[model samples]
Every structure is written in structure tokens, then in C-alpha cells.
Target: MSRHGRVLVAMSGGVDSSVAAGLLHEAGYDVVGVTMKTWDYETSLGGSGVSRATSGCCSLDDMNDARAVAVRLGASHTVVDIRAEFGDWVIDRFQADYLAGRTPNPCVLCNTHIKWAALLKRADALGCEHIATGHYARVREHGGRHVVSRGLDAAKDQSYVLWGVAQDHLARTLFPLGGLEKTEIRRLAAEMGFDHVADKKDSYEICFVPNDDYRGFLARRAPAVADLAGGPFVHSETGEVVGRHDGYPFYTVGQRKLGIALGEPAYVVRIEPETNTVVVGPRSALAERTLTASGVVWGKWAGIDGEARLGGRIRHRDPGAPAVVRQLGDDALEAVFETPRTAVAPGQAAVFYDGDDVVAGGWIDRPARAQPEASPEFVALPTL
Candidate 1:
């Protein structure tokens, strides 16, 4: 029997995951590497004449690379087909969110709903005690709860995207690269004789979207979007139709390049899908002090009793700002920032943090148009 029991590691044919599996195997754990086939590159080309070389993840080459790594370590590897699940949940939601004029983070949704959930099911079937990944975040038991915290590498910290991992899944999950930096992982991969994956480039684009062109992907997925094109870009402050955009779905909140010159700088402040209107305004108009979020997933605590001051992130790249969060209902809450956060995009994940540990997170539903006055006391904020 292995010293640490059987562990199922998600190998994505990347340096991080490969190194993670290597480390686990070297530590005397019965490691099983699995590469999930989430999408097919040929059909995902969207008739854009894009080649398979431009594809990011879940490719045939990736699967073969993962198998090679497993063979090198004398471990077992399996490729599971998850294209149907991914399409029904992640891809469908991606297309639907664009049609609804909301910028959806497909990676976040995949991780929360499909990726971990699927991995857990596969692990159970394989008699594995735990499932591991290459994500740069730490999970530990804290205060009788499984808490996720930021990785040591701030530049590569992925805790923002991992807030939706439920407490139960987190208990049986592991992040081997959480304590190590990217450079260390690369170096370790080289030291372990996996030269092919030691310097593999990280794939940033969405798996199914070729060349990071989400606008084109949406256009191809939903042909009806063509009719929504040529919509009016109304000014947020003056309520005047300043320009016209190809489509509201193609634009996201805080997008600056409108392809039309307005004599001054302008950004998308809001998108009204009901009217097929894209609201544009000066940069100042993009600042939002408060936002309402639904589908709350509590992490550190079951629920927030009252108001708790925490750092709230509106998007993945956001550094987060000081905010006081208050639970409004069973699965809804409002966040009042100490200072205004720019481009509070609806349909994006709003993750809250207490120090480095994730407190809870939810999908942003609405952001208040008026910037409420910032005060030292949280009770002074107005109701939604």
C-alpha cells in the first residue's frame, strides 16, 4: 500500500500539473494522473479558419503529453471524456451570459461546477482518497472549516478563481503547488527529468474559444446576435446616443475601445440587454461603491450574521478593496466598498476575503448607479 493512499491528480499537460503529480509520486503516494477531455478543437474553430495549433487545453496533444508524463513516473493515467458536461454547463452558460449582456467567467464556472465535481466523482469510482490539482492556492482546516488561502506566489495566486470550491470538496482536495512558486515548479520539473513539460507555456485563453476571441465565439455560437448588432451606445450621464457598437454582447463593462472617436476617452459603464443598449461614459462614471450579488457560497462561515468588514474582489484580476459585507437573504448579499471600485461588472464573481483566506463569494447581479458617500461606519450605508 502507498504511504499516503491513492490520489487522483488532474494533469493538464502543463508544467504545474506535471510537477504536482511528480512530487506526489516521489512522496510515496499512489498517484493516478487524469487528463479531462473537455472540448474538441476541430469543431471549436467556429469556422474562423483557425488551426489546431492555436487551441489551448483539452487537445489530443495535451492528452498524449499527460500520458507520457505518467509513463515516465511509472504511474497510471486516464483520459476521461467530459465534453458533453462541459458543453451543457460551461459552454452553454458562456453563450447565454453573452446573449444576456453579462460577462461570464467560464473558468470560474467550470471549476465550481464541472471540473472539481467531475474529478470527485472519478476519484470515488477509482477508490482514491483525495483529488489534487495544479492550482496555486492553499487549502487547510481552519476554525472547523476547510478554508482556501492565497498561494505564496502573489503574481501566480489563483485563490480568486477558487473561492467557489465548496467545503466538502475542499476537504478531499489538495494543491501540491500552492506552497511553491512557478519558477520552483519549472525547476523541479527539469530536475525530475521531465524536460518536455519543464518549460511548457501556460494557456490563458478559454479552452473552447480559439485565439481568445470570445466576441467571435459568441457570434458563431448564437447567430441571432447578428441582429442585435449596430445598437446605440448611449451616454450614461447625458442620456444621449453618442455612438453605435457592433453589438452589446461584444462589449463588456469598462471596455474602452469603442472603434469610434468621441473627442474624449469613453468606457462602457453599463450594458442594458433589455434595450440592446451599451452605456458609455467618462472613466469616473465607471466607479461603483456598492454592488448586489446573488448565489452566495459561504466559505469560512455558514452565513454572515450582520456586517463584516472584508476585502472584496469584483473580478479575477482585481486587487480587491476594503468593503463591508452584509447578508441580505439566504443566498444574497451586498458589499459596500470603503472606496469605489471601478468597472463593477455584473455577472462576474465577487469574492470576499478575510486576510488571505476566502470568506465567501457570489455572482454580481447589480451595482448601484449612484456612488454613496464613504463613511467610517458601515451602518450609515443606504439600503439596496
Candidate 2:
């Protein structure tokens, strides 16, 4: 019998997860480690057009490492193959979003729809009270609702990707590394005699697309989209076709290299699949003051009361910017940034935060060049 109760810990064979599992075990919890195999290395092709094994989280080596760590912790380990689910929910959405001329954040979708959903189901089957992972974010009860907050490690805070996690799932989820920094996690792993695990580098690429070449991956997966090659690259400011691009689907907003020499520096400002047009212009063209988002899931508050003062992070690496978010509908909201933000891509997530705590998040429908609609009830609040 354990003091805290049984916990199902997700171990990815990395130092953070390994240390997380060890910490839970040391804290007198009955830890059952699970290594989720979301992709197959033998079938997935790298950017080199070869099916080769790699050392990422999805590889067999990672599963083996996770099992070894579980054994050392005296915890039972299981390898769950969720590749089918992963492909259906994550991979298909990724390709579909790109084909629709939007930039999708697959990591957010995977963490919210696939990983947590799978873990909760597994935890229920295993008679575990809680499910845990190595994500660097904190979950707590605020105002009678579960809210996710930024981690202690600002550099590695993963709260941006966790915005879409449903409230019920957030209530049952636990992040063991929420309060610790990466250096501390590595030190803990080293002290546990897992020096190799401590030294392992973090995996940044998509699990299925190991080469970090998304353009190549798209071409290989949907060969028909290859026909979209030789699309026109139009200038956003001036109504002129500057050059031709390999394909509109292969390009994402904010990409600098257009493969064509434009006299001045250029960036991809927008993508239009309807006409197979890739809009390019100066960096100034990417700036947008208003953003409309859909598929919103509220965290800190059930919904925005009138206009809420918050900060919006358009991408994972964004430092965040002050914004006023207003609920447009049940599942949609509009955010107007105090200062125009550059590269506000559609299909990417726009996560709103109240200080360090997540307020709500949604997929950006589009960044509006126009200002917010004038209404009698709309009153501008002080900057967040």
C-alpha cells in the first residue's frame, strides 16, 4: 500500500519523464509506467527518403529505456501501441490543416486529444487514481475550476501546448516536473545512476516526421498535392505576381525562403489554397492587430465576462503580447492585440493567459486587419 495512491506515469525514456516517475515512486505512490508508441520507425520515412531507425521518443530504443527505468524504480511497465489513434487524430489533422492553407500545431492536438485521452482510459482500466506525465506545466484549482499555469522553468514552460486539454482531463492529470527545472531533472536522473538518460537530448521534431522536413513529409504522404507545384506567389501589398512557388501546401506563413529572388527580402504572409496562391510581402505585411479564433476551451474562467484583459501567445516560442479577448460565441472568440503582432498565422493556436495562468485557447480562424467591431458594451480595459 502506498501513501499517496496509485499513479500511472507516462515515461518517454527521456530524463524528465524518468525523473518524474522516480519522484512519484519515491513519494510513496504506486507508479505504473507506460511508454506510448505513437509511430513506427520502420514504416515512417525520413527526409532523406529512407526508412531508418532514429533515437527519438517514438523509436524502439526509447521504449526499451522506459522499461529499464521502470524496472529500476520497482514499478511495472507497459508499452501501449497508439499509432492508429495517433494517425487518425494527429497525422490526418496535420496534413488536412496544411492542405487547407493553415498552420496546425500538431503537438497541441496530440497532447489534448490523443495522449491525455489515451492515458485516462488506460488509468481507468488499471485502477489508477491519477495519470501523470513529464510536461513542464502546473495544474491547480482556481475559482472552482481547474487551470493550467506556466511552469517554474520559463525557458521550458509547456503551458502553450496544454491549452486545449479539457477541464475533466485537467482535473485528473498530474505534471511531476511542473515545479523543477531541466537541470534539476537531469541531476536527479544522474543521481539515480541513469547517466545516459540524463545526457539524452530533447526531441523537437514531430514524432512521425523525424527529419524535421514537414514539406517533404507532406509531399510523400499526399502525392496528389504534388500537383499543386508551380503555384503563383503574389505580393500582399501590391497586386502583382512576384514569382512561382513549388507548392502552396508546402509553404507556411512566416517562412522566409521563397526559393525565388525578390529584389528586397520577403516572407510568406498568407496562403490561399482556393486559388493556389502563396502571398508574399515585406515583414510589415505579417503584422495584424485583431485575431478571430474558433474551437475555444476556457480554463481559468468559464467564459469571458464582457472583455477580459489577457495576453495572447500565437506560437509556442512567443513571449506573449497584451490583448483584449471577447467571446464571440460559445466556441469562438475575438482578440485584439494592443500592438500589432507579426506572422499571425491561421490554423495555429492562440492561447490567452491571465498573468501566468491560462485563460483560454483556440485555433486562429484568421488575423483581421480591421479593428474590433464598435459596440456600446465594449469598453477598453487597462493593459494586462
Candidate 3:
């Protein structure tokens, strides 16, 4: 047997995965390329929004693209049907979050449940020792334990959405293309005569919803959203009625383009699903000092000792900001910033970091009742 383990590369029918599969093959690993037919984009009726539940995997074009690359790379390719699994684990949860008026990250959910979860199963069935993907992230084993790290290129690093991945999964995962940058990957692919992938533009918008109209996509996928429409939009500071919107869930915090123009430039300050109100405000009100997080995964908080200070990044693109993190209870953490950070949104997640090591982190709680920063010393969460 070769030193390289049998690797199962999860081909998403894209240039990234195509290069990853080829690299693994060149490294002398017995490789199998697997493209999951997670959802049928054709049946969903052409790029409609509601990317989570309605239809998925972009379209037949994506699947065919993956198949062509796998054959060219001299690897056995298989399409594993996972429609039912995606619906249960991914789609249903996506619709559920939107209806509840939270801006859920479906790709994070897919990485958590479907890609790593489902593909890992196929790897076991094929007796493959590891599974690989085109994700721009890397894993390294240090001191007898596996650790996750950013890819070679900062622009392509996808470590944020992968926080929930298990240490064992990292140990058994291969990221062949991670050591290279995007330009290098494309250049290498073209050199190998992979025609379509050479000029392929990476898809940044929601894949299944090609049109990118999420509200209409939701209405078409789940009519429940449309039923909860025609609510009042309010000014955040004054709580004065500003305009009417179809739904609060349709908008995300920190978004400025979609708002109805007021006399001054106003940002989305808050979203109240129960009251069906979307609050807008001037930019100043958007700054926040402390954000509450729950669902703490104690296992992933490796480097932290007791109380530790760290930087936190709520969104993917953020450079992260300095914050003092303290455990409130067995499962809750409080993050207070040295200075307020702007455009922090509630319904999204706030992932914390202690340097490069992941200290405990979780979902961002809705804005808490404001007490003066000096009004009182903060208290730990009351234990049950």
C-alpha cells in the first residue's frame, strides 16, 4: 500500500474541487471523486431563491461539470444522491430560521451537517481513510492532535464557517488545493487542459437561487413568509414609523442598500419578527460594545485557560476586533469590546477567537436591554 491513504475528494463540480481532486491523484493517493446530488436545481425551476429548501447544487450543469473533471483527472467519480438528507438537515432548518426572522447562514449549516457529515459516511463505505474537499482551509496534526488552519491565501480562507467541524474530521480530511492560491489553482488547471474550469468565475451568490432575489425565492419556496408581510418599518432611535416592508426577515442587519431613503442616510438597526417591524437608524446607533453568545462548544476552545482576552469576528470578511471574553455559565459567554464595533448584527453568529486558536464561541444573541456601561458591574449568567 502507498503511504498516502485512499482519499475521497468531495467534488462540487467547480474549479476548486477539480484542482483538489487532481492534486490528490498526483500525490499517489488512491482517490475517488464524489459529487453529491444534494438537491435538484432543475426541479426547483431555475435559480429561484430559497436556496436552502426549494432546490440545490446550483443545477445539472454543476453536476455535469464535476463529472467531466473527475474523468479527466483519471479518478472514479460517483454522484451520491442526498436530496432527502439535505432537505432534513439543510433546507428545513434554513426555512425555519427565515420564518423566525433570523438571517441564517445555510452554507455553514451545509458544512456542518451535509458536506462533512454525509461525505464522511461515503468515505467509510469505500474504505477510504480520509475525505478531501476544495475548501480553502487546511488541517494539521500537532502534538498528536489535529488542528484547523487557514489556507495559503487569505482571500480564500474559509475557516470561519468551519468552526463546528470535529477534530477527528480534521484528522481524516485532506485539503490538497489549500496550499495554493486561487490564481495558481486556475493556472495549474488550465495547464492540465481542463478547459471549462480555466475561465470559470467563482459563484459567490447563493447557488440555487441564481436570480438572487431571496424574498421572492422565500415566498415561492415557503408561502409562510409572504403571509407575514406588510409590517411597519421604524426609525431605530426615535421608534417612529418610517415605511412598510414585506417582511423583516428579508433584510439583514448592516445592510444599507435595500432601505427606503429617509431624509438622512439610515441603516437597519434592528429586526423584530414578532412585531413585524424593521428598525432603521443613523450609523452611530449601529455601534455595539457587548454581544451575548450561547451554544458554547467547550471542546473547540482549546487554547484558552481560564479567563482569556481575545479578538472576535462575527462575519467572514471582518478582520475581527479586540474583545474581552468571559464565560457567563456552562454554555453562555459574554464578549465586551474595548471600543464599540460598528455594523454588528444580531441574527448572525459571533465567532470568537483567542489569537489563531478557537476559544469557545456561539450564536449571537439579540441585543440585550441597555444598561449604562458604568451603571453597574456585569454579573455572570445565573446558573440553574
Q: What CA RMSD would you report for each candidate? A: 6.2, 6.2, 5.9
Provide TM-scores for the models.
0.95, 0.94, 0.88
lDDT of each residue in 288-365, candidate 3, tens digit only: 888877655543455444566787888778778888887877767888888887776654567776556455556666
Candidate 3 yields a Cα-based lDDT of 0.71
Off by over 4 Å in 2: 46-52, 370-384
Report clashes for each candidate as comma-separated counts: 0, 0, 0
lDDT of 2 at 94: 85
- For candidate 1, the 10 contiguous residues with the lowest summed lDDT are 375-384
Window of ten residues with lowest summed lDDT in model 2: 375-384
CA lDDT scores, all candidates in order: 0.86, 0.86, 0.71
Angstrom error of the Cα, residue 33, model 1: value is: 0.7
The candidate scoring highest on TM-score is 1
Candidate 2 achieves a global lDDT of 0.86
